[model samples]
Target: MRGFGELEAAVMEHLWAFPDGATIPQVHERMQADRDIAYTTVMSTVHNLHRKGRLTRVREGRKHRYRTTASRAEHSAELMREALGSGGDPRAVLSHFVERIDPADSRRLAELLATMEEPPR
Candidate 1:
């Protein structure tokens, strides 16, 4: 969301929520239900997302249906990775991040790490 403006974020959120892809009109309708927005605005936002490689679109009959190229979790992970890569000792960054997480999340992270360390079956 940090990398996108208001309209762009709304469009991306809608596409991610709909996974099956939606036409510009569908996205516009959803946005309209939430607040006032123009059809051309949704159309341009989706086209921009597609051009930026954040979304993919396919022509479905007379309409182009758009969907997220990456899931929300994947995008979040990428953002985290980018943050870690930004001029810091990766170990320290990870340690600080892990230290701040809640106990439940820490336990889950440990369990995931343990599972990752196991040899493949």
Candidate 2:
């Protein structure tokens, strides 16, 4: 339910870009092209992501190929839900959230809310 740190977020972004999944070395190489990061650092970050249940891995010979357990949009929604629930008043939180978004997104949110079925009491 927690958000990712800088390195973990970068690793997740890279993995999300590759739908077929990527090995630690593959991720490290991609990361290295942009910055001077160590291979072991990427390896540790990927392993931590897997341990956090944010990623799923399959044995690819000696190394594990990793992919995100949820889509980027899904992860964002989960984080929003967590944030909403963390507050004492969800209504106030949602009100603030809606107020902060752009007009187009506000309209879209209204449209989505209008289409949702009411829960049975």
Candidate 3:
């Protein structure tokens, strides 16, 4: 969500929610209910995201059924890692992010990272 542009995030959210996946029209219809967006606009957004490796689609008759290529957590983690590994001040960024979390959430994130640090053969 942090690195994704507005339309990209919205498209991802739609795919994540629609587990069965959907065609451009379906996604456009669902999203248009909330916002005054054009079909071509949604279609363009979905195509651009697909080109960015954020979406995958299967051919269904004459239409393509689109879905999220990765889970929300997986995408977010990849974005976070890219940001941290960009040679910037990761420590400062992390400190800022940690400061925004509740104490309980900070502990839970620490525990999750600790659990993930185990070596695997």
Candidate 4:
């Protein structure tokens, strides 16, 4: 899958922020408040995200409201997983990552690993 450009990431951030989803005008309006952005550019970005399976949309009257198909955390995790599996030594990659994380995150990761080892309820 092609990586997202700045505008694409911004659009996705807006959709993720608005769980109910947002129309192109809504996103464009918010973005334009910060900087000049063309409505068509936002529209095309949302359409591209939808086509890439990163977003889902539904028609509401004359407009389409878009939402992310996966939560940000899930999307990030998938990216990490893909990178780990991408012809590199997974163990080394993970070890290097773990070694670089802060102590708090390391502790949290340990806790999560412990929880995963628990039997199903």
Candidate 5:
């Protein structure tokens, strides 16, 4: 899978904030508070997200309430894993990634890694 575009990202952020789910009109209304956007644009974006399998929808009266297939954190982890497997040496990529992070984050990562159980063969 690929990352979201500008408008798509905005829509996803709004949807993520609504854990229960949101309709196109609801998302469009919230987004209009920040920027000038058309309702149809929001509608199309949400529909495209559903087509991409990023979102699921259920009929709510006359509108469809949409929800993300995964949580925001899960999506971020998937992106990280995708990047890690993209190319070249995994260790080298990880080493560079570690080097770029702040000390606190590095320490936190180390702690988490230490606590994690190894996957079964």
Candidate 6:
């Protein structure tokens, strides 16, 4: 696994792709279009996602429909926070990232900060 387990990433991708929701069979079919994972693999992956709080399920007939519990941006931010927290001080970690910001971007950030500091909305 590069970052997350193969099943986890695959399941998350499917959940993020469909904002509404999808059943296990739907996800399995989609995955089949790409690489051919077993149906049970998809089912258990969705179950694990549910347990991880990355997905929520609703019953539909005899099967359960799964949907993303959080938006992609929300999930990414949480993961970033967790990754940073895993190290030492977040400030120190962020400071390293800040130092590497492109010069043009740094200037833009300063301009935005100055505007934000101004009183009034």
Ranking by lDDT: 5, 2, 1, 3, 4, 6
What CA RMSD would you report for each candidate?
1.8, 2.4, 2.5, 1.4, 2.2, 3.5
What ranking of all candidate models by TM-score puts the best one first? 5, 4, 2, 1, 3, 6
Highest TM-score model number: 5
Report the C-alpha lDDT of model 3 over 1-121, residue by residue, as the tens digit. Answer: 3467898788778888898888999989889888999999999999998898778899999999998878888988888788777747989889888999999999999999988998886
- Give the RMSD in angstroms, all C-alphas superposed, for model 4: 1.4
Q: How close is candidate 1 to the true structure, as a TM-score?
A: 0.91
lDDT of 5 by residue, 6-117 (tens): 9989999999999899999999999999999999999999999999999999998999999999889999999999999995899999999999999999999998897786
Candidate 4 residue lDDT tens string, 51-80: 889888898998888888888888888888
Q: lDDT value for candidate 6?
A: 0.83
Off by over 4 Å in 6: 1-3, 101-121
lDDT of 4 at 61: 95
Model 4 spans with C-alpha error above 4 angstroms: none
Better of 4 and 6 by TM-score: 4
Minimal lDDT window, size 10, model 6: 1-10
- Whole-model lDDT for model 1 versus the true structure? 0.88
Q: Between prediction 2 and prediction 3, which has the larger lDDT?
A: 2
What residue pairs clash in candidate 2, if any at all? Answer: none
- Worst ten-residue run, lDDT, model 3? 1-10
How do the predictions measure up, each by TM-score? 0.91, 0.92, 0.82, 0.93, 0.94, 0.77
Question: How much RMSD separates candidate 3 from the native structure?
Answer: 2.5
